[model samples]
Target chain A: MDDLTSDVMFEAFGKTLEEVFEASAEGMFSVICDIDKIKPEESLTIEVSAEDEKTLLYEFLSTLLTESEIKGLFLSRFRMKTERKNNQLIMRGNAFGEKMSPEKGGTVVKGVTYYGFKLEKTENGYRAQVAMDI
Target chain B: MKGKLKKLSEYKWLISKELMKDMRADAIIYANKKLLDEVEEAAVQQLTNVACLPGILEPVLGMPDMHWGYGLPMGAVGAFDKENGVISSGCTGYDINCGVHMLKTDLMEDEVKPKIRELVNCLFANVPCGVGAHSKLRLNSRQLDKVLVTGAGWAVENGFGVKEDLNRLEENGCLKGADPAKISSQAMERGAPQLGTLGAGNHFLEVQIVDQIFDTGAAKVFGITEPGQITVMVHCGSRGLGHQVATDYLKIHESAAKKFGIKLPDPQLVCAPATSKEGMDYLAAMKAAANYAFCNRQIIAHWIRESFSQVFGKKWEEMGMDTIYDVAHNICKLEEHTVRGKKQQVYVHRKGSTRAFPPGHPEVPPLYRDIGQPVLIAGSMGTASYILVGTEKAMSDTFGSSCHGAGRSMSRRASLKKFRGEKIKQELEKAGKALRSTHPKILAEEAPDAYKDIDMVIQSVHGAGISKKVARVIPLGVAKG
Candidate 1:
């Protein structure tokens, strides 16, 4: 594992959440919707600062899934602002979503889970991984 | 980033601020190295997330039976300042007052073993089990409100339990400030016909015998004379009523969290300030569900007594089938505790945890105040359960809480996939234990191996002085859902 800056890790997380949600929707709907149609609003920034990376990812995704369900929006863009502060990963991210329509996508992401969640800093970049709870 | 964990003692591990950001205090877990190693990292992450919650006092603690769960871990305990902290439904889980109630009988194992088959048969016939199982006693909307407000008292007044039973129950069997109006129509409908039924997944009623005495003085206080004395332990909760309350509030809390600017690590931990409308509604509804659960268990206990009376041609009173104590395992209560050396009213959430108030606490009933609150820990069938007492350490350390049971070692699906119900039943029968159940799949999910060793889990807590063991119970027969 190589040393990667927290900012880089945070960026990767934001991108990953956006990509995962879109890909999951595409997989569920069996059609790829135009991501460009969904616009990113001023980030309703939320942060999950925890000791370990695994739970950080679990909590982050779980929060996003919950927020999406409550707000009835489908996330289309994500941008992470992460920093290593005092030995903990402090993650700040903007998760963007468009109004989910049955005609556009067949289903919504139900939840996020802790199963198979991983966060590791490799020689090239930081990777925060998770298995979406459908 | 991983930081070195400092061993506070043999059973305590400290995760310092050097390991997490915005942590007001250290995160301490009470478990041996072996147990600690087995804990999911997700739980530890949740602990650190809890540290970020406003006005947290001291270390966020996890008991030995710790495992991953929504928001807070199953065996987690934390306290916060009343003025600043938030209240979370996830901290209490979907099942409100999902707890344990132990009944003592005059009959010994020698007396009941000969009639074990008949006894279990009667219990199986009387107690409803399995998912969506409804009872013969259905409640109208108006009567359901009474059940919510009065709790076990309603059951007793309706001849479900005796008056003496109230004295042994926490909150005297009825929680204050329970507004039935706060409960949703869906919740009421769900609970209307399920009053006396044992809902599925880890809920059970077991016929057990006192197998060992750890503290003779406490054992005597709790009325366990010696080994082989038969007892009954009932483990269930508010059924659909509580689940509906939780679901109703989870949405409210999510919106409340955004409005209040409360950021949580997990959506399950979504919450509102203690004084917010969302928080108040949740408390009211939660109390109502708690009452419903109390009444639910009271009814089941009554039928158990009735079943015994039918078989023995004697009244329950003549059989000495008295409730020793009933304690809620999952709940949040507004309690006054010393914070910064001043008494402050804070909501304490116990998820997969039991209230273990020390002796002489005003909240404890008068009769058992000197002996401390009886903490009942029910184990998987064919394993040892325990009766314990609250200690001063528990009051000071873990928000007057103790472990609920041998917490799940695996998921229900994993357990069912690994173990067969028929084989498990045969194994128990070979060991001279009788089993009766409505759902065979439930038996597989609740197989003994699905849970941690209750003996070891109880020993760790007892050894730590958080709670002291009184009596150990071995199952004679079990009724599972």
Candidate 2:
């Protein structure tokens, strides 16, 4: 995870696609919540399909941001996996968090931005960068 | 070819189409030499990218406060043809209709100074602040739809404000053609509970005193009779609902761009042809979210009225608390403007800009139409916000627009590293401005040092004859989310 102009950017790497996706989700939540305080008492599942890996990554993080507002929860831990089926990228994911409490630190991120958004394979693994609008 | 900008005037510069390939129009910027030089190449590149977009009616324009943004620069304007141009969700921003409004009060600084701390505390308690701060009223789905349609009118009808407030708001506080059905359930759910919340990051409610009045006649029209008069400034927008609208539509626009065969220089510029089904749908939904923002601010304004009434132990109406004006900086609108001596309707995308209609323009509310639209340029927490009036020059030059705020000279991360929030708070307090916020880091990110000298930005526009300075308001108390 890193930073872009006026937005929070994340870079996640792993040997498998699911590992990078999960890392990306965790990195996003870590920016908005203290993961240590989250008890993982509530579980949420999200499913989405996009044209490619980059769009898939954007939608995945966007869903999490929307869920935070809709469910009134500050999510922390996340588990996800992506698969390519019939030339489309499909993602099924689960997120964990609890109700938003004032004791929680960190600011709210408005949305994910396409500014400097990219997904690529590293020398050792797959990597993705997502910049969130804070 | 990439960074060359030909000086056009003292405060204007042009990047010819020769600077970038596929550019349909020249890129123009309203900036002084220092500001022009300070603009990064990447942000300028975004302007050139905007120039290359299809169906642009005039030169791509950037205000003095211009900086890098997702697709278009933050302080950029791109007015496109209604039939042939495109509509972009990215251009409108994440928090739709994120804007600032000012309310005037008869009380002066001397009257409020002794009770400044109490007043600040009352405002903080009355108005919801911080992330996930829920509104006192949890509206159902049906009421949410009414907000998406009636805008501030809904708030007034619900006893939040008076009918006269609708007259002072841009678009009468509601945008026509806003189809609530176009809004997704996700956007609805997020909006329902979040109404009236002062969301985090740069959103604030400030108690100010009329520090200086530049144009006495203009200031008088804006309800500023004398210096030291108390005023309240509310800065916020359509919290989660507007964000979700932009987020949901961005994906649709991305696919629509491909479907329309529009090759964008940046993915963030993804857009649909303005007349296409996708474009129409996005516009409808965007308007709905924009209305939500209007109501959101209206509700806050009502609460602010209550807080003032409580602190003074008098009715707000008896205290002469009246809405001066409300304007949205983020969002696009269909407006009639004269371009190259021809009258036409164009969709003006003002990302980090405000509508500054010249005097006598029909769109200008009747009350101030003879004077011009009141342009509110909010400064950083530590500086003075200027009230400017629109000029005819702006109508022909920049689609009747002006800079929105003290545009950030540095990014949030950079500011965080350069200044501590606690130190900034202390500095503000020492300077007689009481600062309160949910998180200290927010104070650091919004430090005045992180932004450009707002006076210089105002000078550029005023000197360029785009807008005229009316008055300056200085902060006495600030509450942030």
How well is each residue in A1-134 modelled by candidate 1, as lDDT tens digits? 11110000111322343343333332322211234555554235557777875556655665554444334354566666667899898767676656643223321222343334456655544555443311
Cα error, candidate 2, residue B384 (Å) = 1.4
Model 1 lDDT tens row, B101-151? 889988889888988878888988798775434487968888999999999
**Is model 1 an incorrect, acceptable, medium or high docking prediction?**
incorrect
lDDT of 1 at B244: 67
Q: Clashing residue pairs, candidate 2?
A: none
TM-score of chain B of each: 0.97, 0.98
Q: Residue B98: error of model 2 in Å?
A: 1.0
- Lowest summed lDDT window (length 10), candidate 1 chain B: B1-10
Which lDDT value does model 1 have at B32? 73
lDDT of 2 by residue, B1-481 (tens): 3357889899999899976678999888999998887777888888888888899877788999888777888888998998899998867778789998889899999999888889998898888888778789989998999999899999999999999998898888999999988888899999999898887777889999998888999888777989999989998889889988888888899999999999887778988999999999999999999999999999999999999989899999987888989999999899988878888889999998999999999888999998999998888887889889999999888999999987878888888789999998888888777888887888888888888889999999999999999988899999987
lDDT of 2 at B336: 89
The clash count for each model shown is: 2, 0
Off by over 4 Å in 1: A1-134, B1-3
